[model samples]
Target: MPHLSLSDLTFTWPDGDPAFEGLDAVFGPGRTGLVGRNGAGKSTLLRLIAGDLTPDRGSVTVHGRLAYLRQDLTLDPNRTVDGVLGIDNQRKALHRIESGEGTEQDFADATGHWDVEERAVATLDRLGLAHVAPTPDALGRTVGTLSGGETMLLGLTAALLGDPEVLLLDEPTNNLDLSAKARLYAAVDQFPGIVVVVSHDRALLDRMDTIAELRRGELRMFGGNFAHYRETVEAEQEAGRAAVRDARADVRRQGRELVEAQTKIDRRLRYGKRMVAENRYPKIVGNERKSQAQASAGKLRGNHADKLDEARRTLTEAEELVRDDREIRIDLPDSVVHPGQQVVEVADLTLACGPTVSLAVTGPERIALVGRNGIGKTTLLRALTDMPPRVPWRALPQRLDVFDETRTLAQNLADAAPHATAEQIRGRLARFLFRGNDSDVLTSALSGGERLRAALAMILLAEPAPRLLMLDEPTNNLDLPSLQHLTEALAQFRGALIVASHDLPFLREIGATRWLELTDDGVREVDPR
Candidate 1:
């Protein structure tokens, strides 16, 4: 039976136009990709499928139990990975039994004769959490101490623990690092239930059995992976455009022929008139011939008009089809830079250690402080700005001026250069796409992409701009086009950049000479090229 089916579904958000209209699709016990451009209602569709939101019209039928993983999860600050995962001493005993370190009587004592503890440990191990770290009780830490990616994974583990019949994930790999993302994919691949993913990750989409593209409130199913869908869709659009061009050409040619025919008819009428004037008996015949010519000309004109209208309508339809099938646009901004190799020269820079740990960067280099979520990428950038030690970037005894994240565009400029006025800061902000009222918004409320842009705006626009610009996960929530623009801009930037990003494509585009791969094993520099 089908796992989840949406029949003639239609939905609209509170403010926007309808997102889906008469959309229909079906998922079986395998992986499927729900792909669309940014703001294409992929998230909303996932919610509907998960039964968190109901369609405004039509029916969403579920033949089996469904589980969903949202992009962001807010967990209590007091729970541990073990508590959240339902793993305890009992579970540990079961693990021992499964590993043959304990007997069946021990397992019975642990699970009250259920023997489900071993099964649970095996399941968790399969999800790639088989580390032999000390228990959280021993560490005296809660889930709140875990990294963002770890917390997100814990949520997924909870969802999977129920053993649902279907799994729905919405951009599950967004904030995860390479290793966590790999583990998530492995889990999805091994899952026994249907997997429906709403994601923009082309890599993940490669594993999908089918791709359902959402555009202009319509769903179009293709029988292959994302690459195949891309090829087929582009080909179809090209064929449509070609058809329109041919039809237009035919209409133009037919118009020219019709005009020529009319001209011939007019010439023949004149000749007949001349013949009538030469012989009075031929006058009546000439008049009849002229009338016949006029009738034929009128008929041709009417038929030509009809054909032209039909051709125009056909062209309109073809253009619409092409537009609907076209790829989404990503408008990437160019990161600006001035010549002079010394963008940032940090010598013995140490980070703060309250909410953030300390670190040192003592070189003029384009670097990346790569790590899992909440591992001080932001802290390092903040030290460059010298904000509150909530997450400070403590510079070690150096004449360092940081481009602060806590300060507004205007305020940051004033702080960076005390004499800089508000007007100058506003002008600079405008150049960075923070125009008019946008520059006034508080830094804390800004979205991830917006904050990154704003930070760049304030710094790059400043007089004697930062030689070393630091960015923290610059592409976290940015849509594709914006990312492309940033990529292009960074490619042109001559100054040093220290960016923390998991987006390999973006890193490559920005032309990082080397990458600082931060893992559980520690930080190591490698050539990512």
Candidate 2:
């Protein structure tokens, strides 16, 4: 069986930041989903397993052949299907052996190459790549004519042709069409070897036999799929939060007892002094009693201090187990529409891709534009912006390249608006939840979620205060927190919104009033529920 083991594995980047520290783990014969937030070293771990990056210390032991499929692949338009599957030389040697012109070396090479053609054909047929490989002569056809998704699947086929013991896939489903994604998922399901895939796609993760989470330089194994792992983590977080609350209460109680003890000691000391003055007892006896009281007070205070310290330590440990899941709160007062206000109007305008959507917005309306890749969603959004709508509009693309990273949030907003006063810009940023010192934060210093909010702020906080906003795949590269932040902001937007996205959960959360499904014949209304 194919397997992998890492013994005290450690890795650090060239920039001096540690990616993994003393990581020790073993992967056996099963499909494992490697999950974590962006920059949590999930991809880095995959690279380490694939031998792309050498470990800083320790060793990786492999029991069988390994194949790795990376995200950014280089394509050669002139390559044939046999070449793409990396079986050209072997297939050629087999051909030479069958033609009676085979040399001794060719005959030797053809020994293992006998079944290479059959195996390549079967793999291509399974992945829906046979259609692009030229039906009669699939292996002889050039792959330059293949689609993007076809190209990716062809690469996966090449990986599987070797029948390796371990296969590592990094974001294999990214940018794939629905049909391609389904085909890839099917391939993963039927694979018999150990498969480790790094992906943020929930649907893909849910197909795994086991989940391994890489968080904060620690590796954790969970049985079952992504849903099961999430349930376990949520339960752990609940218990951790309860522990934190209990520890805090204990600290408070200890503090109160310490103060009360001091007060009682002071009262007793004063009483002893009064008794000595009144000659109720000998002055020496009173003095001795006072000294004893002071000693007891000091010991009591020390004991309470120790208890407080222990409680604090307990609180810190509990906090480490609990993850922060705060969502953003948006309040854009400027986007409000009074009576008789005009919004964007889409007349029976048919798009170049043949999608005709006609709607008039007079209030805060939210529209969800969804379809498969290359369905003219972005083109439609760009068309809407050119309609010369009654209100100002801005569209946020997937890259979010609007903000100047070198400038602060406030400065960026000011640069966009230009006419807005400093106070105005800051107040607008506050609506996007960037209040107080957050205004001075550089765009480069913000998290993924904060950067998104900053982008939205700059758009909606324009000179005329845009009432029409368009967004394209806002949740593409966002982690969980960033996704939540985007949902929160969009849900509360007081303006019109037309968002094109494939995230069903996000669309449901925003409560989109109109769901437009772009189809072959323009767009059809669908219930996103």
Candidate 3:
């Protein structure tokens, strides 16, 4: 049976435009892909279904227990990882073990009721954090000390604890490593509950049973994977185009006939006037013949006029079809420097901040930059991209890292090169999806994926396009199709791509020739094969 139903739903933000109205959807026990463009309300839908918010109209009904992994991290920082997971069962057992004040029935209820500890340990192990024990260790640690990526993983694990009938996961793999993404995929595949995931991960979408896309202000469901959904949408577009073309042809044909009939009627009327003006009493032949021709012409003209009007109306409808079916364009800038061969040359480069932190990346390579969290992957990218010194030291000149979250994308780039004028900066920003006021908005307001795109777009706009494209987590918040499109475009680009991402399938699909692996101490190149 289906686990959830959304019937005739309508919702909007306070003081903001309406998001969706008259929307109806149903989801059952299976992995479902939820996809949409930026600001299309994917997050809103998830929150509504999770019961965090109420819809202005319609109903959202859940038939069974539901668990949701929110985009924002929510966990008890004071508790240990195991303490968080073992909350329900461990408390019962520990209560019985700690206080001996209970009868046989109470002891049984507390002791053998549930194997909470075992379940907690298993869940932690599944999350690749099995080393964490239920009790405190030498390192005084709680969930608070864990990295954002680790916290996200643990929250997901906790959400998956009781095996509820439904699960709502929002970008669960956005902050994970390649191995962690695989773990998430495995967990979702084996889960018996209904799953609704809002993610931009293309590799993950390939595993779904259905694709639900929110566009403009409407939601559409397609029965298949991401690729299938696209194909179906395109097919519908083609059908709409065919209808428009047929309508146009009918209009043109009828219009020409109407013009020819009107000309014949005018000529016949003039001939009749000339005969009457001659005053030759040729009334019988001229009048009768003129009347017959006029009647014939009038009938033909009326028929053609009717067809013309009908055609005009059809043309108007066809135009509506054209406007409705056209796809929105994201206007990417053309690249400048087309290098012949060697784009970036990196030697035995070792980057380090302190004694406990260091990373390395060898040059003349197509490397996948990878690590767990709080590691120096992004730092290494900053060094490569030659971004401003947030630290005390100066970045390398040759390297260019594309992670500009400091200011408005344009302002940051303009600051990077003060010699450039506002007009030049505006031109550069336009290509990167930052046009006009978009260039003025603070970087903090931009979405993760949009920030990455803006940064890369600036790189592509560079006079001599950076030979070495050092991207720090480029696929973070991008939708599946956008990521795939980017991957395909990057494949065509003849440059050294040094990307720091945890998306394994994304890395593999992009054909990373090598990998620069980072640890707490330093970095090394590894062959995943």
Candidate 4:
């Protein structure tokens, strides 16, 4: 069985921010879901394990061969499918031998991989990429023409070809469509090696054998899949809350006891003074009795004070056990439309991808755009938002590149809604979980989830308050918490929404009123219910 281990691992970014410190964890022979907040170093940890980045200290050990699929793939546009798969050289060598131009060097280069093409085709087919593997010429097609989902599948196929014992995938489902996602899920299920995936896709995480959470520079492993992990965490949190309640009650009781003890001491002291004033006893005897009384009172006070301090400490410990997962609380009152107001109208619009879409949105309808990869979903979204409609609208594209990277998040929001005051923008940002100095952080430095949140803030805070909001794959790179926050925020939106995403669970959670599937012919309405 393949295994991966990190012993006392520590890492820090170029900016001197520590991502992980003294982290120790082990993964062996099962699918493990690596989860964390956007900046919690899930991706960084994957990079370190894949040898893309070196840890500042400690060691990373892999007991078998490893392959890693990165989140962001920067492939040359001119590279062919075969070239991207890293089998181009082998294929050329086989072709040379077949054409009677064989040389010793040719066989050496081929390395008995005469069936490499067949294996490549089979791998591509397994990944639902048979469309691009029909012929040799098809495999020669430039990568520039491939859809985002297809490119991702191609990357996966390339990784699969290696048949590594340890496989690492980071956000593998980011650009995939519904069908592609299913295929990827199947691949993951069938993989026999040790699979570690870092993703926000709940459906994918639900299939894992274990869930490893990286939080505050520590790795904690849960015994089962994401669903199991959620159940465990919820139970622990409930217990933690109960403990806090009891601790608080103890503190209050201790405080009251301390006050009562002080009151008793004061009464005793006053009585003793009166007795002395009356000369109730001989001088020496009275003095000795007074000293004893004072000592007893002091002891009682010290005991009460000690109990109170201990109670406070218990409360602090109890509070520390509870998780502080803050959610984004936002209400877009200005964005609400009238019950029957027309939000969007598309009349026989032809997209650049050859799809003709026509539709009308009224009131606060939530529409989900669904389809396979390269079926013009993103293209349709672009077409719908390209020209201004009757109502105010905003579109969040798949690429979250709407901000000026060098500027701070506050600056971007302010630029989007220039009429709004700095104080107002900051207030709105706080709702998005960007509090105080967080709002002043540069957009370039934000994590994937943080960038998405910042983009949403800018869009929702526009001057006119867009009544129609369009989002293209909004949940791609978000963490579980960020995804939950996004869902919560969208639930509060009273305007029309057209979100193109393959995350069916998220769509359902957001109360999508209608579902539309984009196709080569046009857009077809599907029953969401």
Question: Taking the tens digit of each residue's C-alpha lDDT, what string does model 3 give over 1-529?
Answer: 5478889999976645587898998897798999887556787888899988788999899988888888755567687665555464445555666687555665665555355556666776787766454432311246654545667778887787756789898888866776777888998899887899888777788889999888877888889887898788778778778878888899889988888888878887887778777965577878887888888987998899899899889878767655342211233333333434434433445655321323333333457877776465655665555532111111211112344556677777676556778898887666444677777766655554455555555555554335455666667666555676777766655455677777777788878988767776666778765
Q: Quantify all predictions' global Cα lDDT against the true fold.
A: 0.64, 0.77, 0.68, 0.87
Per-candidate Cα RMSD to the true structure, in Å, reads 7.8, 5.6, 6.2, 2.2
Candidate 1 has its poorest 10 consecutive residues by lDDT at: 390-399
Candidate 3 clashing pairs, residues 3+ apart or interchain:
346-363, 384-399, 384-400, 385-399, 385-400, 385-401, 386-399
Best by lDDT: 4
Better of 2 and 4 by TM-score: 4
Candidate 3 lDDT at 438 equals 70
Q: For candidate 4, list the clashing residue pairs, or say none.
A: none
Against the hidden reference, what TM-scores do the models get?
0.73, 0.75, 0.72, 0.93
Can you write out model 4's per-residue Cα lDDT over 108-157, one digit (the tens) per residue?
A: 98886777888889889888988888766577777775667888899999
Residue-level lDDT of model 1, residues 1-529, one tens digit each, is: 5478889998886645577888888877788888876556777788888878888899988877778887646668786555665555555676677688987666666755344444445554555544412332332246655555666676787678667888888777766778788888888888887888877677788888889887777878888888999899889889988988987887787778778877877787787777778885566777887788788878877887777778777778777767642222222223333443333333344543233233344333456556665554555565555632211121211111234556665676566556667887676666555677767655654433445455555445544444455666566544555567667776666455677777878887787765776544434677675
**lDDT computed for candidate 3:** 0.68
Error of 4 at 483 (Å): 2.8
Residue 204, candidate 2: Cα error in Å is: 2.8
lDDT of model 1, residue 79: 66
